[model samples]
Structures are given as C-alpha cells and as structure tokens.
Target: MAKAEFDTPQLKGIPVIPHLQPGAMAHSRPFVAKAEHQEPLGFPGELVDDWKTKAIDKMGELLTKYRALPVFLDACVKCGACTDKCHYYLGTADPKNMPVARQDLLRKVYRRYFTFAGKHFPKLVGAVELSEEVIEDWYRYYHQCSECRRCSVYCPYGIDTAEITMAGREILAHIGIGQKYSNEIIGKVHKIGNNLGLPRPALEDTLEGLEEEVEEDLGVKIRYPVDEKGADVLLVTPSADFFAEPHVDGLIGYGKVFHQAGISWTLSSYASEAANFGIFIGNYENMQKVAMRIRQAALDLGVKRIVVGECGHAWRVAYSFWNTLIGPFDFLDPKYPVPQHVCEFTYDLLQKGALKLDKAANDDKVVTFHDSCNVSRGSRMGDFPGGQFVIPREIIKASCNHYVDMAAETIHENTFCCGGGGGLLTDDLTELRVKGAVPRMEALKRVIDEDGVTHMAAICAICKSQFTKVLPFFGMGMDMIISVHQLVGDALVLGAEH
Candidate 1:
C-alpha cells in the first residue's frame, strides 16, 4: 500500500476545529471513471457533448424523485451547527469541505434552475448557473466527502449532506463523470460477481486455503462452504475479506461462528460481494442491480437466511436498503430479519449460550472499538436503533477483558469516517484519506496515550483497511486496526468433535 507523499496533518492534541487553510485540499480530488467503467452502469463512456444540459436535467430528475434533496437545498439557514463537524474540514481546513459550503456548490445550481427568486434575482439569492467552474467545484468537493453524514446529526434541520453529495455525484455520472474507485468496482461486481473480481475457481481455492490454515492454527475442522444449496444462511461479504489482512481474518471468524453454532451457511459466487457502490454514487438503478444479485443468489441456493459480512456501507445497504431494493424476501424465513448483520448473528448465538468462550485468549491486547460511519449512522442491529453500536461493543467485551473507548465524541452516531468510505479508498486519494483520518486518529491517539489501547476493532472492512494503510504514515503500527469478529474468533472455545 505505497502512497504518494503528502504533508501529514500533525496530531497536535486533536483540535476540534483547526484554523482555516483555504485550498489546503484543493488538489485532493480522485480519479474519474473512464467510458469502460461508466457505460456498463448506464452512464456515458466519457463527458458528453451536452454535459451541462444533461447535468441540470439530471438534477431536476433527482429533485423530483427524491423529495429530501430539494428540502436539503432549500432548508439551510446557514446556521453553523455543522461548521466544526466534518472530518474533512477539520483535517484539511478547506472551507469548501465544510458541509454548508459543499451543499452550496449544488444549492446554487439548484437555485438558478429551479427557484423563482434564484431565477429572477439570481445574484440576490446567491444563485449561479451550472457552469464549467461550478462542475469542477462539485467534482472536487463531493469526492472529498466520505458521505458519513456526521454534520447532519449536528444540524438543526437534520439536512443530510450525504444525500446532497450523492445527488451531486449522480448528476456528475449522468453527465459522463464518475469516480474510478467506485464505478470500476461496481462494474467488477456486475461482470465477475465481486469487488475483487475473483472467479468461482479462485474463490474456491481461497476458501480451501483458509480451511487448511485454520486447521494448522486451531486444529479444528472449520469449513468454508460455497454454493451449498439449501443452507439456511447465505453469506455475502466484501471481496476484500477474501484476501485482505484483518478483513480475511474476519472472514475466518464468520466461518468459525457458523461451525460452532451449527448453522448451515454458504457463500454464493453468483452474489459474492456485499458492498453496493451504487449507494456511493447515488444511483438507485445501479444500487438495486447490485442488490438483486444477492437476492438471485439466495433464491438459487435455496437459503432461508442472509447474513452480511463486516463492512460499513455494505451493511447499510443490506440492513436498511435491501428490503426496498431486492425484497419482498418472503421466500426466505419470515421469522428472521430479511438480511442480518454477521455481528447480530454471532451476538444471538452468544446470547443463546450456544458458543463456549475463552476471554483470556485476547488478554494480550487492550482493545477499543471504532464505530464505522455507515453502521453507526445509517444501519441498526439486534432489534434496536443503537444496537449497531452496542452489539459490537458487547461482542468485544465478551471476547476481551481490557476493553476501553476512545474519546466520547468519536464513537457511536458521532463517529468519524475511516476516511476511506464512499468509494474514496484508492491509493490516488491517499493524501485526502490520510488527512481526513486526523480527527479519528487524534481520538485513537488519546486512547493510546492514556489507556494504553493496543488494538482498535472495527466491523467495516473499509475502516480496517483504511487504518491499516494510514496508521503507518501517521506514526502508528499498521496492525493496530483489527476486525471485531477477529477478536471473537480469538476468544471462542472449541471442544473435541461431537
């Protein structure tokens, strides 16, 4: 994970709102998608001849389809409740990175095209036509956002800037503009069935390798099943879990849980990926298309239950959007939630006293949980709103004896982005990702200094990968970030075969 050198934001006591450095991150935009990646997703291969008209028309379409977009555009009174809330603004000091200013980039365009006051008294109402410069600003700032929605939580209007950002991104894609990191991955998911594009044979080989490795290490015959029809559960996880460090460990953890709980589960090569990049781009069609693959896989495999692996935005799509995008999941068991988080599944097993424990297994490291943004703000687990926060913490507590929290402000709904979400995890955006991680890193640093916390557990694959890559650049060990289920795997007790 070599990165282009950039100035690292100094960790000087975790400033809540650092002094402004306008244009400090003006150069942090990500690589745009090419025609090859865009066309399969129903977008133009490149910028169109009438991209301006197309962009404005697409905005109008979004405004009509999503009622909340216009309200967010019109509702801001410019109160500064969200002023200090964005991790990008805190980390990079670019004023446009401020949630309000970012919204204004699209608001002005909305005003010029759709509002009476903006159309007539355009200057008076702060309206501007959708010009090339405006599009440039939209591309630059929107890509900088992780779409974490932390500012919306602080705003009096509850104006979710993430939606605004998504609308802006959708408008860009319709006009022949898209981010490569997300579009390319979404294309892979559609064409080859996963983000990593690992085919069925390779996937089977990887699972086989994991089985042998687990046997060598644990002396237990844990199985990683694939395409086993009639299994009760279908496991859909991010492709990163197939091989990425910390992420792969979590995959192994999932297998261990299913084995011990005696729950029949299988992974579908047809719908191998849980992540839906459509949510990142704000394209409902593409999002739904990706989700439908999972639905099809469940039907084909005859599985009654679906469980999502450790991912931030992936869980959000599965827990919150799956019912709408791919349901009615009536063919599956009606008693169970349509799609469940792996944490929820494991927690249920633990609650039912189905799995034996050895908490001392994780005593070597003191632990803290980094609540991933999508899981914290967008989705829920265990039948409650904040169960997304509580269930994972409870799992960690059950697994490790020395568990503590980072800064109070940096966990749960107020949590910071891992700086790699919203499809901005590619190496090209490493500078922005590194800087955007400052606030969370600052909180993590405090715990390291005060609590001697050695490892941070996360359910999101993006958070684990982000911290693993950026922590080294920030003078921390890359291995400090870990998956929550990795801790669970460490503490589980296995007896001789029954």
Candidate 2:
C-alpha cells in the first residue's frame, strides 16, 4: 500500500539506459472491480476459490482462440530487438516495462503449463508456475502497458506485445481480477450510454447551451442537434466532448463544420459515446455491445452518414472493428464509408473549398499536431497508407497560419502514446502516467523551445485530458494542449462567407 517514490529525471534530449529496477513499479496497481462491475461484464463478482486454475484455464482458452498469443509466446528468442522500443522502458527504466519483458510475464506462465521444457526444467526456459505472487505481478505490470504497439513496429518478426498485454488482462478479468476504472466505465456505458454517464436530459441541455454560445459568439444559430430523426448525419463522439475542456471545443468545431456544410446532423443520446473501453479490457462481447448502440442509433435516426468526433480508439473500433462487430450497413445509405472520421469530413470540405476558412484567425498562436496512437498506427484515414498522419497536419495548416511538427522521430506512426491510454487514464495510476510521459514531454519540449509552438492539438479526448494534466508537470502551461477542431472552430468563417 505504500506509494513508490519516483524521482523525476531530467531529459537530456537523448535516450539514456537506466539501471534495471525490478520492483520500481510493483506497487502501481489499479483498483479492483466490485461485483456490480464484474457481473455486468459477464465476469465473476470476486476472485474465485480456485483462481489460479481458472486463470491458467483462461490463458489456455486464449492461446487456442488467438494464434498470435501462442506464436508471440514461443517466438521471442530474447534477441533484445525490442528492449529499447517501449516508452515506458524509456521513461521509467524499469526492465519489466520493456515490451519483451512485459510479454515474458505471461509467456513464462504459458511455458510452465504448456511447453515441455518449461514444465520440466522451468528455470532454464524462464518459466514460472501460476501462483498468487505471479498473479499479483500480472496485475501490477500488465496495467503499465498502454497497448500502443509502438514496440511491434521495431520487432523483426512483427511480434506484437500489445497482443500479449491484452491476453494477460483478459485472463486476469476472467478470474474476477478486473480493473475498476475500465469495468466501472463499461458499466456506466451499459447503463447510461456514455463514459461520463451523462443522461439524455443533460446531453440535450448541454447541446442547447452550446447552441446559445455559438449564437452569441458567431451571431449564427448553429445547431447541435440530438436524436433528430431523418437527419443527414448522426455524429457519435466521445461523451468527454460533452463536458471536458478542449474536447468540448472540438465538439463545437464539429457543429460549425456541419453548419457550414449545410447538412442536417443530430447526436443520438442512445449512442452518444464513441469510445469502446471494451477494447481496452480485451472483451469482444462487451466491445460489440458498445458498438451496437451506434448501429441502432443510425437505424432509428435514419441518418445517411455516420461521422465520429475527435476520439482516438473509438475511431479504431469504428474504422477497423465496427464492420465486423455490428455491420454490413445495408439499412443505411451507401454514399459514405458507412462511418467516417470528423477530420476526414472536414478535410474533404477543405478540398472542395466548401467552407470559408480564415487561416489568420489562429494567427495569435503557433500550433503543432500530436498523432494519437490508435489512429496513427491501428487505423488509417483518407486513401493512402500514412493519411492518418498527413490529414490532421493538412487540416491544421489550412486552418492556421503557422504549424510545426514535433521531432520527426516522435510524430506519425512512430508517435509515443499520450501515457494515459489503454484504460490507465484513471487517477489511481497518476505516478505511472506521469513517468510514462517522459519521452513525449521531451519531444514536445524540443518543439516548444525551437519553434515557439504555443499549443499542441490532438484528436483524442484522452490525449487532450492527459496532456492538460501532465504538461504542467513538465513546467508547460496546462492550456498548451488544445483540440484540433478547437483550431478549426477558431479559423472557420461563418454566414455566407463561402
């Protein structure tokens, strides 16, 4: 229960190999889910009497179901190719934070139960039996991984540690060992339809408030519609956008873009949240349940297109998984991609010169774009391979006078996670979150010092929320992190300008 004392290290603008500290973050663990959270997600209410056996059985089930799990466990030759790839390793210098080391936490357990060498001569193959101590180690270290897959990009055999991390969490959850933050949020979404648990009345009231604010500022009554049947588009954004700073600003920007495009769009209180935390906990049934809300909303609303707001993992689920999770979309119009990113929608408008944008509107500030991990590597945008990286920057450039990127190594597909991803954004992991952000902070610092960048814009709500909190720890202003569409809203010219 004692908090680990983490001495904040100074960044030298170069990666430094830290002394291996085995138990540095052993105490960093998330809250356990209660019966309410666990039962609703189809997990046991509490740790079963034979949890060790059940956990091992769950691991066996996962290995049989997912070939990647078995292949990754057997394939790693300890070549150290991925030793230096993880941001957590770079930040904390904990050897267990290294991707391969993290994978071994579960791999060792797999070997003991399944592999002959591991079962007979366990010490030689680095295998260990499934015991209470090993289970506790799983709880501590697996939560440290953000599932960013940055390490996989460097591995010669394309060994994805994210797969191992997901398997580890899934097995833990099966034995009544769920993380409270993610399970509780999933419960809320199941009950109230979004992560924040904002009710339909509150959602409508907030949209109305936004309508009045836009009318006051722009002198135009731009609509933030909710559940309006027969609309042209149904906007499914993260619930954080309804209340959180910079996220709310991006929501306002979406309203402005839709207003300018002269399209009829409504937000469904039924599917208000785009974020599917089910992906974080590696629960496919829950992920599908979360995703089905959107399909139902689209059906009920009779919307022609589905446009998602500024959220990272939500886009991945929508872009990559939705079709498989709840799709074929035969009931809706076929004009668009079935579901489209708000950035792609706005960028398409820019390409067609549909909206009147005054780039000088953002003249007072110099901006940089942060490529969110899920969007950058897990999914793609536009028609090309790297469009996820290109499109966001293009939008910033078109909407602002000055835009600079962070270090070439730090941006695009090689981007570091915002440190609060993969359900680790809760207050419980504050130390881990802050330490995990060291590399990103160093990268952002270089840009700030060199380019006079006043703000960094992100498309992910978690990124915005994480940066707003962690940036201050690095002596940067909390307000330095802005939403991408916050810039778009600023630079957009309304009322017959086109």
lDDT of 2 by residue, 225-308 (tens): 999999999999999998889799999999999998888999999998999999999888999999999999999999889999
Clashes of each: 1, 0
Q: Write the per-residue lDDT of candidate 1 for residues 365-445, one digit (tens) a residue.
A: 999999999999998998867999999999999998999998889999999998989988888888888989999999999
Candidate 1 residues lying further than 4 Å off, grouped into runs, are 1-5, 496-498
Q: Candidate 1: which pairs clash?
A: 35-45
How many clashes does the backbone of model 2 have?
A: 0
Which pairs of residues clash in candidate 2, taking residues 3 or more apart in a chain or in different chains?
none
